[model samples]
Target: MSPAAAPRVSVRLPGHRQMALGLARQRLAIGILVFIAFTGLLGFRLIELSLFDGPVQRARPAVANPNIRAEIVDRNGVTLASSFEAYALAARPRDIMGNKEALIAALIRILPERPPEAIRSAIYHDGKFRYITRRILPEQAEAIRRLGEPGLTLEREAERLYPHVGLAAHLVGYTGIDGRGEGGIERAFEQRLTDPAQLEKPLALALDVRVQQALESELKAQMDLQQASGAAGVVMDVHSGEVLALASLPAFDSNRPGGLVGMPSHMNRATLGVYELGSTFKAFTIAMAMDTGVLPRMDERFPTTPIAVGRQRISDSHPKGYPLTVPETLIYSSNVATAKMAERMGRQRQEAFLRQLGMMDRAPGELLETGRPLTPAPNNWGLASVLTIGFGHGIAVTPLHLATAYSALVNGGIYRPATFLKVPEGAERPGRRVFQESTSHALNGMLRLAVLDGTGRQADADGYRVGGKTGTAEKVLEHGRGYDKRRNITTFAGAFPMDNPRYVVIAMVDDPTVGSRMAGSVAGPVFKKVVNRIAPVLGVAPDTSGASEPDIRMFEGLYKPRDPKRDPNAMRRAAAGLPPLEGGVR
Candidate 1:
């Protein structure tokens, strides 16, 4: 109140001064609002960068997420296929700031795999951007970064790695440039591998790494020894239909799949390459006869003399001048007897039996590379077709098909589709019945006899009670010039511990040049070696006493003992520049 009284006599402030004061106040208020808005915008930008924008996104290139692809492992947790973070070298040609020559030199030094001229040409290409390389190592990226080239940018990317390399290449497959699976297991389970829910869970295959290694090594060794054009093999659990090992040659590396496009070596012969798997089918014919009661007695006899069907004359490779019993027919691998068995079954019944055994369709399994069986059309399937198919010549199928069929035949007549997944213990899959249990048992005994005294003598492992059949089919000449007498596709399909069948193995060699070229000579040894190597790893204890062997006394006097001097494998050993076998026919 005292101050108001003192100012009462004074005049009011000038209008310009009052206006200046109002303007100052307004300016102060506007400054605070501007400051607050700027602060909010800066905070929002920081949050967006921190949460959504990182090195991968800022690179502005398509990059695969390593975490998206689930690791692939064997049943024992041995890593087969995996994915990892890597770097790619990309360029913005228009944005070049450093010396072009220097940059090119640096790139050449960093990546010796890339051609020097390629780098130079890429830099000079008329384009806004280019990828110098993709899936480069971190060390390479760092080396290139030291060049300080403004045009060059290193991008984070996902690289699919096959730690085992070509070990299980065909089974694990490979991812494409975009990181999507393209073949094998990778393609078969693309959805599962890429699913977010399953990313953390590894895909465990039925394959045992040790078993697979042994199989591949032995198969490859045989292929090299025989100088064969190609080879295929399969090891499967007879009871559960689980494929423990599948191999094909010449094998390509999974890590370097880029060069494998359209190459025959890239083919998965185990599942994709079809061949006339010769005498392996004889087992099926004999089993069919037994199951249908067409041949009720094991001693039922048929002439081994060459038989004529239409215009085709079928003869055994090593002909016997006399008739052979049903069991002896399989033991000697006589085509004439097998043909007669099919003739008795009739074409209709033979076709029906094969259909039930899955010989009329593609092999059922987890592989997308499975080949459809090549069989005579129903309308064209005549008696001749039946006879030849019975001997395994008229029908073409993958090695996997024979393996699966053999598994069914030996696994107590149950037919289960082959699988690559690790089945839980004590939880076997349900299967359909393909043969009577008695029929299977009888066939097992006859096959054991074959290994003991006939064509598969070389296929026996010391303590495994190995039993198998050998097949030798002439390859049709290029351009359909009829079958070539010199070139053969030889195969051996068999099971071990025949008394309680556990595994089926199929091995095939195409056009072997260095051996006798017969299945017993070329392919039988592969089976023997594989069984001996993998049996111990698979927990199959050796039975040195033959206590667990199948009884073959049913054919006691039905056939003559095989002569050691006539062994087909003798010619193979001689041709390979090796000494003759000291223990012949073993």
Candidate 2:
């Protein structure tokens, strides 16, 4: 072999020190490279979190960490329910370097809405934290808890829990999956509900559970019996103007609202249903005439002669041709007489009366949705228009409008707006005056007569001395070009304890079919049924005078000379030629 190629092998080398030097150099280089790569990665992560985070992080501990559920309470300091800190499953796709598949399977058990495919993609995406399930039930949460730590994270967050699921469903609206109020008092008082500093206080509502239940029960029975489309009932304290019971059927269970039908159950029809209010406005008109010193006696007659408006006919449900007295006008609900009164009062006086009674405006309350009454301008008002309005026509008002007006008429002519929340002591908002004291007192007696002997007999309770008006206006249908009078709205607005009025009850049914009993038949009876249930709960004992009421008549046939020769058939023929019909009259 050549000398250059000869082996450099040394015998008995000391500790192989020269070989160790080469190996150490290689190891040092690897260590430097690893440290530099780690620093770059950490810097990138800091930038990503700081710059790209939105409400998620502020909501993160809320969305991730399970330590911040808020508490919910009722007015009486009852813990209807509360939430506790619980882990919500979320994932940072990039951070999940392990099995993306197995992690998703674990996640599926917690949130079914997100299928395995969705989870896999989420775990593989570049998001910081994608929510898997928030506000999970305790059982579901426990199941997720059993999943050992891997790609799964149990970050602390507040989970909403409703203790009494159906008790206050309407009052305490539920929160979104992320713990935010969506409706009812929860949404209304959201600032208060989610207020970090003021959660110690419970949300106080003016609802009495007992009264609400009673009202609901009666309304439900009627809804089913009548097989009606829908029903709403309200009981308001005439004196305090506090809403005792506001029940709208078809209510949804707020605790579980996933599959709920929107718009129907959630709608507060009592405050939202604006209708012509039929003859319910008659009481207000009569009161206005009485207060204005126009109708001096119940026996004073209005020329029961049918009058014709521009395109509408003024008549009564029950036709009378004689000069009917004021009491008879109300007892028989003479649309012609009412129209005459409206004409005498004129549009200016009518508007003034309505404004004074708070009917020309929206119903009073803290509800986000309050209905406004529709009163066309007076200049546009004509004789027929004024007459129709006096008898409660051409002008559409809400049930609340009727309620407020009735309350004023009974509460010594003081108009008070209705409220859903508790009003403080000495906080009685003495509303503007709509009726005079004597006028109200006299009307109360006349109203009692109507209940005892007139069209309002159905609303009379055995002892409550309930006096109210029945209104049934053909439902104004908007066809292709004009309104079709195919449907109708039937309503009854009444007050109890004729001697001392305390509460005003308003019951209304929309588009009630022409059954064996019509609006006066169906709606009036339904209203009486509601009164039956609510009167006791409201502590308004029966007067034991249901069988008897004060003696008062609408007219004495003394206001105007009665013409015996006035052929009723001629007036009918004249009214039949009642201005060419412009809108649907069916």
Q: Please report the candidate that would top lDDT against the real structure.
A: 1
TM-scores vs. true structure, each candidate = 0.85, 0.77
lDDT per residue as tens, model 1, 467-499: 999999999778964699999999999998887
Q: Specify the poorest-scoring 10-residue window by lDDT in model 1.
A: 54-63
lDDT of 1 at 233: 91
- Highest TM-score scorer: 1
Residue 66 of model 1, lDDT score: 30
Q: With candidate 2 superimposed using the best TM-score fit, by how many Å does residue 492's alpha carbon deviate from the native?
A: 1.0
Give Cα distance to truth, residue 177, candidate 1, Å. 0.6
> Any runs in candidate 1 off by more than 4 Å, and if so which?
1-67, 562-586
- Model 2 scores what on Cα lDDT? 0.67
Pairs that clash in candidate 1: none
Per-residue error (Å), model 1, residue 517: 0.5
